[model samples]
Structure formats: C-alpha cells, structure tokens
Target chain A: MTSKSTSPRRRQQPPIALVILAVAGIAVFIVPLIGLLARTPWRDLPALLTSDVVVDALRISFIASIGATAISAVLGVPLAWLLARVEFPGRSIVRGLVVLPLVLPPVVGGAALLFALGRRGIIGGPLHQMTGLVLPFSIWGVVIAATFVAMPFLVITVEGALRNLDPRFEGAAATLGAGRWTVLRRVTLPMIGPSLAAGLALAWARALGEFGATITFAGNLQGRTQTLPLAVFVALETDRGAAVALSLIMVVISLTVLIVLRERWWRPL
Target chain B: MNPLAGLDAHLVVSRGDEFTLDIRLRVPRGKTVALLGPNGAGKSTVVAALAGLLPLEQGHIALDGRTLDDPDDGVLVPAEERGVGVVFQDYVLFPHLTVVDNVAFGLRSRNVKRGPSTAEAKRWLERFGIADLAGRKPGDLSGGQAQRVALARALITDPDLLLLDEPLAALDATTRVDLRRTLTDHLAQFSGPRMVITHDPTEAFLLADEIHVIENGAITQVGTPDDIRLRPRTPYIADLAGSNLFIGTAHEGTVTVGDHQISVADRHIDGPVLAAVNPRAIVISLAEPGGSSRNSWNTRVERIEHYGDRVRLQTGAPLPLTAEITPAALDDLRIAEGSPVWVSIKATEISVERD
Candidate 1:
C-alpha cells in the first residue's frame, strides 16, 4: 500500500534538467538516433531486404565480424595477460602499441593493413611466391582489416579486468600443484569470464560496423567480400531510399544483438 | 610414517638495501614449530622462501632427505613442484570456483581424474563440516567458511610440508580463540611437519611443540615454549614469554643499579647485563618482604592488564618491572596503579646473562 501510494508521486517528479546539466551533457548522442529513425525509409523496405546483394553482404558481414572477434579473443587475451602480468624492458611501449589502433583512423589502419599484408609486402611476398596466395581484395582481407581495428578493444578490456582481479587467487592455484597454464585455464580465465564476454561483444560490434578498412582492403565485392556497411555505402551513393532501408536493417540487427546480450549474458534474464 | 624428516633451510632474500632476511630454521617430522616474531621481522619472508615462492640468493633447503633449494648448487624447485601447501594470510581461495572444486583442484592437478578427486574433495569438505556448501563459490562463503575451505584446499594434496601464515590473524578475537583450538587439534593429527608464523605468544605456545623467537632476520632464541617463557633474549620475546626485561649489573651475588644493591644468584659480571625474570615469579605483598628474601623493592604500581587467568601488573621502581599474579591475589591485595606495593623475588628466580 505504501509503495502504491509512492508510485504517483514518482510519476509526477519535478523537471530538474537544466538544474543538473551534467547528466544531460551527453544529450548530443540522441540526435543521431533521432535522425537515423526519421530518415529510415519504411516504404520499399521489403524489396530492399530481398535484394541479392543486400542478403550476401549481410551474410559476409556477420561471418567476418564473428570470425574477427573469435581471433581477437584467442590472440588478444594472452597478449593482454602478458601486458598485465609480466615486466620487461619496453613494456610501457608495448602496452601503448596495443591501443594504437583505437586512436588510428580506420582508413589509416586499412592502409597499414595493406602495406603489411599486400602481395608484395614483407611476409605477403613470400606467401604469394610460394603458395600463389594473397590477402588483398579478398574475404580474408576484410577479416584482417576488422581484426586490426577491433583487437585493441578486446585487449584493453580484458587487461583491465585482469588488473582488477586479486592476484592471490593465482598464487593459491600455484600452491595447489597446478602449473601456469592450468592456473590460467582453470582459475584466471574463469575469474575474468564476465569481462571476456563483455570485451568479445564490444569487439564484435566494432567489427560489424567496420567500413573504411573493409572497403579499402576488400573492394566491396558482392557475395564475396562486401559487408553490410559497404552495401549501405554503395546504396547511399546510388539509391537514397534503398540506403535508408539497408541502414535500418543494420540498426535492427545491432539493436537486437545488444538487447539480447544485455538480457541474457549481462543482466541475466 | 614421517612425511618430512627434519626440514632445514638457510634462506637469504634481499628486497631492498634495508630489507634483508638471512635466517636458518628447522622443523622435525610430525612436529608443529611456531616461528614467533613481531610484525615486519621477516617471518613472512622465511615462509615465502621455504614455500619456494621467493628466490634465495644464498640458501640450502632440504625436506625429507631431498634437496629442494640450494642456490649455491643451482637446485631450486618452484612452488608448484615442491609439493608444499600454503594457507596464506588471506586464505586465497579462488573466488570463481566452488568450495568443492577449489579443494579438488590439487588432486585433479596430480592427474587423479574427476570422479575420484571430487569424492576426495567431498570427504575433506565433510571433515571440515562444510559439505553442504560444496556447490557454492568462494565469494559466497563467510570468513570462517572460507578459512575451512582454504584448509581443505591446502590439505587435499597432502603436500610434504604444511605452512600456515598467520592463519587466525584475519579473524575476530573470539573466532580466533575458537579456531585456534580447532586448528591445533587438526594440526596435532597432521602427519607432515607443520610450521605456523604468528605474533601471538599464546597461539605460538598452544600450537608449537617448540618455538623459535626471530628478530632482525635471525633466530635470536630457540627452545620449548616453557624455555622461551623462562628466558627470552629480546624485549619483544621477553614480553611475549611473560617476562620482565631490564638492564642491570651483577657482581658475585649482588646486582647494582641506580643506587640499589639487590642480591641475586650466580653472577659473573659487574657491568651491564640482561636480567630477565618471569612475571609470575615476583610476589606482591602489602608491606616490606620479610627477612631471608634475596631481593625486595618498594615500587609504585603503573598499570595492569588482565590476561585470562592472570593479571599482569606493570610497576616502576629501581627498574621497570612487570609482575603476573592471580585474580584472587589481585582482589586480596587490592592491587591498583599508583598504589605503593612491595615486590620480592627469590634469588634463584632471577636469571641474569651477559647481553
């Protein structure tokens, strides 16, 4: 009865907005969402969704982003562990380098990926000469570009989680006759499981939205290398209505993934 | 069977220029040895060195006729392979694992597969009376429950040596006393040589068959609990062993200090010396002690602290002296600080040694 009586008063709360502008300081973010929703074309949405180019780009985008996120967890986690745990000369420089891609413009990262993995590039030349293989303008190039740009998010997140964990747990595992690998697998990873999940989600989201690097490296090929963002970019140049429909689909998929993630893995539905 | 036969270690670990631990310690098989020291006296360093967690610049460690660490000879086993179990100051239970899984961890690491190792973990959890909490994580356990889980975790492997680093320091006073006896009984039944480091004398005396008083990274004194109580070498050890320590002089059978010539027993020096006598040895009376008493002094009472069955009376006289007496004695004499009292000790009770 007391709670019921308090509900109306809660609904009639005062306008304390400008009185406290600190919380409302980030209101600029909502303008984009408002603009996106308003400009998204509702008519001809079904025809746009049924387009063969749209379907193939969507499939490639999902596959490449998920693969990049998987690769990030495998390689980035151990590197994060090393950055967090071990001490050596140039450690600070190595840690700084891990976050380089976070600040590097996506197009610059694409150029960097091309120089390193292009057909005549350092390790790329030997691979091309020996196996007649190259990563440039291919589905694999999209993965490389996404991984390059998205790995910093996974590494930094997992590293922060590792730093916050009480190191005594690892010591306890050591005294229990477990070696370093066993301790990492059984104790350290499980202890940071929440952070791992959160980091993977963030990295996957970042990869899914990758455009500059994927287009520069993979050349927006339909059904082969083009991702959803690339498809949306091409549609924006040619057909504005179709561009809005593709963008709405991207928004829906991202929103659904985020909502499901929050409900299932994060907040425990 | 003796799990460890006479573990001997001479460990030297230096952190900074000022912090150094160079001490040798020994624990016989199936005996509980207490490493008694004050805070920051390198007791934990000794434990860490023995557990092989810290590297020693100069040391030789042998357990049960096996060479575990000897830096001079280049033989050092890391902590995991040394087969030494440790209960750290904070218990160090894995917060992500269940109580049972934490206990079963050691067995599983030794390649004893899941079902049997978990059965062993269950038995240990039952032994510590925490079987119902087996499925719960370490974060869900209370202090006492976590301590028991840590104990079960440390003991499941049945390591060669069991080292406890201030196991009860984290608990409340009441929990400490209760757990002290429980831990003591469990340790008494432990087959391996056990070592515990603590600053509490009562804890040391209760759990230790023999006690070693450590000061400034060296073993200052080593003896049974009674021996330490009777003759403590340093001020901290003296206070811990319930003895009043003072600096005085002895010539023949008389000690002179501050214009007071007190008669004592078996004196060889006429200059400065360390004089220690048990607080329980001094008797307090309402008047001057009668004739034939070797030493008697009129002193003003300073302070008093109740220690379980005994009352520790601090007094200022010819020397700062602490006396131990029964509560009954306290009531009979009406002992209070600022009250003039007569303190007398037999010549034989006072033990004097050159510092």
Candidate 2:
C-alpha cells in the first residue's frame, strides 16, 4: 500500500492556509443555505409553494429565464464567436463593453436600460413616436433586464471556450469546401458543445436569480414582472415561510442545473 | 485524370516581420511537389497562400487557367470556393464528429443530400479500411488511422488542388514509415495537382515527384529529389541532404576554403563555388595515407554520433568535416571523441557548382 503511494496519482496535502480558507469559503457559502433549509416549514412546504402568488412568480420566473437564455443563445453565441476569432478596430472595446453588465451593478444596468428604452428616453422616445410601443413594465421588459445582466455570463463563457478552441479546425473545414456558415454551424458549434451547455446553464441560473434589474425596469407587477427572486424579496417582509420556500426552490433549481452540468460537462477532462 | 489542369502561383506574402515569401511554383496535373524547408522558412505560409487561407500581398494564383487570386485584378476566391483540399499538419480531423460524418462534411457543405453524402463518406472510409470505425470520433482514432481519414476526407472533395501539410510528421517513426507508403500510393491514385509541405528531405524524396527547396521565404532551388540532393543550393539543404558543403573560391582545379586548399575534379566555375561531399565520400585514417586522393586534412574528432548501423564522426576544422564510417572501421582505428585523425577525400568525389 505504501509502495502504491509512490505513484504520481497519489494526492498531495494542500497548504494549511488554503485548506483553512477553502473550509471557510465552503462554510460561508453553505451556512445560509443550511439556515434556509432548517427554517423551511416542511409540513406547510407543499401548500405554501402551491400558493397562487408563489406559483405565479415561479411560472413568470421560468418563462422570463427561459426567454432570456434563448435570447442569449441567439445573440451571445455570434458575439462570442466574433470576439474570439475576428480582429478589428475597437474589438477590445467591444469585448470590454460585452462584459460591462457582468461587472456593472444590476441596478445601474436597469437604470441604463431605462434611459435607453424608457418612455421619452433616448431610443424609446423615437420608438414611441413611431410605433407607440412602450417596452418598460412588461414581460418583455423583464426578459430584457434579465438578458442584459445574464447574457454576459453566456457570452464570456462561450467566448473563452471559443478562444481556447483551435482555429485550425475552422481552417480545415473551410479547405474541405465548407462555407463560413457551414463551418460555424457544423464544426465550430459542435466542437464547443460542452461550453455552450455550460454557458446556457450559467446564463439561465443568472436570469433565474435576477432581482434588482427586473424590479427596477419591469416593475413589481405580480405574474407579469415579479420573478422568483422578486417574489422572495416581497415575501421576506410579510411571509418568512413563503420567502424561505421560494428561496429554496430557486436554490434547488440553479444548484441542480450547475451540479448536473459540472458532473457532465464542466469537469476538467 | 480530371479535366482540371494544375496550380500555378507566384506568391508574395509579407507578415509581421520583414519575412516575406516571394516564390513562384507549379504543380502539374498528376504530379506532387514537396515544399521542403526548415521551420519558419514559410513552407506552411506557401501552403496557406495556395489554399487561399492567406491572401497574397502581391501576385496571382491560377488553377486550370482560372484565376484563384489576383490582387492586381481584384480577384480573390475565398478558401471554401477555392476547391483546394488540405490535410493540416495535425490532420485536424473534427474531434466532435464521427469518422464518417467528418469525411462527409465537405460533401454536405457542397449541398449534397445526407443519404448520398453518408454513402460517399462510407466509400472513402472503406478505401482507408476504417469503415468499421465510422461511428467513432477522431479522438478515439490512432495517429495513423487519423491521417488516413484526413487523406480520405480531403480526397472525397475531388479538389482541383490537394495540399498536405506535414501529413506524416505527427506519427511515430514506425507508423510514419507505414503511412508514408500509404500516402505515396494515394498520391499516385489522386490525379490532381498536389503539394506536400515537409521539413524532412527523406519524406520529400519518398512522397513527392518534384522537390522545391524553400529557405528564408524564397525557393532556393527546384528539381527532382536527386538533383536537389546531389547539388544542394543552400547550406541548410546541404545539411538536410546529409552532406558537408564548403563555399569558397575555385581556381582551376583547386578550391580555397577558409585557408584550406582542396582539389576538386571539375574546373567548372572559377569564382565563388559550392563544393558538396557526401559523408560517405570522406574517409578517415589514423595517419595521413599517401595516395591519389588529393584532399587530406589532419583534425581532431569533435563528436561521434552513433547512426544505427554506422558511426558518423565530426572532425575539427580547418575544414570541418562529417564522415560516416563503419563501426568496425571505428573500432579498428580506435577512434573516439577528441581523437586526432586524418581525413582524406578524392577530388572526383566532391561535386562543385557555382554559388
């Protein structure tokens, strides 16, 4: 057994400081979750979760998050490809701007979205005058807010993956009589399938957890803009049990997705 | 053979540094040209330029009288439309796709239906004897299997020009030998203009009908492998051709090389000349032998390389020489590194050409 210990696969002890900090990190991450689980009204869990307000919020959150993920996939994938492969003037600036929403406070992003698409706002003013359409305080607006904050997760993840992929594959495809579109659809996308899945999962989770932007831009209209996090926030003041149940639901969903994705795709090969 | 003629290109590619490739090449129908050069000698650049991956800074590429690239004429065919199939240095088989799917990609891109495309891809796999592994991804295939698949994929396109970039460089030595024969056979069957980029002279000789020696971004010489090997134009090619070359002034039959005067058989060029002597031509002796061999120099052995069956000795200057002798000769002469020895060469054995 000791002789087998000489093999390279034998695990080495981590540094004491790293071990301490890692344990501390895990404790901080899980402690709130433990508290939420402990405080959950198990007997009343089914009834509380099935309440009209909670169910409606959950439904809205699902629709909005799924919509956001769809939008991100449609727009963010091409943007990621562009950032990873193309070289142009202002490319670095464009890349920095893509990640701005990720670092920018959600409230600020909401405010920016408002200024751009709000009534009597910059683009919104013209849009209203031309089409008489108002985007704010709508389900579409909630999706837009979640997308603004969440698409960056997908974009950055996919971009990093695209950057790491060998561009030679694309070259090989092209030389094999594959057009740009064919190569993108057939070669480039398929090669980065895992990263795409991971990015979608991450973006979906972020959209599901979105609060400040949704509340600010889409307003707190129940069943319309009030998603899971918004519902949790509102319930915390009046119904702690409902809030805990809602929070637990959100946690379970996002954690389940991330865990399954980690096991299937995200783990280092 | 196909109706498509061949490739004719005069390419000028200037990249970041002052490294510019200004070379002209031609690959006739039913012939393969091996672009031989060391790394950074623009071998891959030439392949890319021909395949339309890299745009020409100046000049034009024409295949079968059709202009592929002409910067002056504002004509540049994109890589996809160029009809040039490439087997990249790494073979670059799409890792995500099954073996058959990877082969069918080119056909599918050309708008062939899935049924016919899969059937055609299967045909190629059968040719490569990997039809059983059609469902397997490229990652699961061994290097040799992957190379054959790459060739099959490229050939299925029925391209006007086929480019193989160091096709066998990634395989292990034994696999390389086996695949080299397979590649040579495939090249014979594919009656299109082909170009193979390789740094190994032996690979160039074995796989290609013609050899183009490229060095420092320019084609130094182009000829049959024997022509290039026997009369190598550059020091790099000389080394790659496995010969020791000396550049000096030749007067009458005597050539002065770095203060050492050696006699050559031909009084061909009087001025600056290149003299190439194969390592097998030079003979080493424990003492200077008085004979008709006109060239003799006393030098110390600098290094001894065990080259499988034979030992190659690197003797010290005033005329630094590399000589291959039998191990029995080495043992009989009691030669080791740093041993003083006399090397002799017949004047007729050295080939002289104008520098």
| Per-residue alpha-carbon lDDT of candidate 1 for residues B149-232, written as tens digits (9 for 90 to 100) | 888889989888889888888787657756776787677656888998988786787689999888878888899986676545
**Per-residue lDDT tens digits of candidate 2, residues A120-163?**
78998899899988888989889999999999999998999999
Winning model by TM-score = 2
The candidates' DockQ values read: 0.60, 0.67
Screening candidate 2 with a backbone cut-off below 3 angstroms (N, C-alpha, C), the clashing residue pairs are: none
List per-prediction Cα lDDT, in the order shown: 0.82, 0.88
lDDT (Cα, 0-100) at B205 in candidate 1: 79
CA lDDT of A30 in candidate 2?
A: 90
RMSD of each: 11.4, 10.8
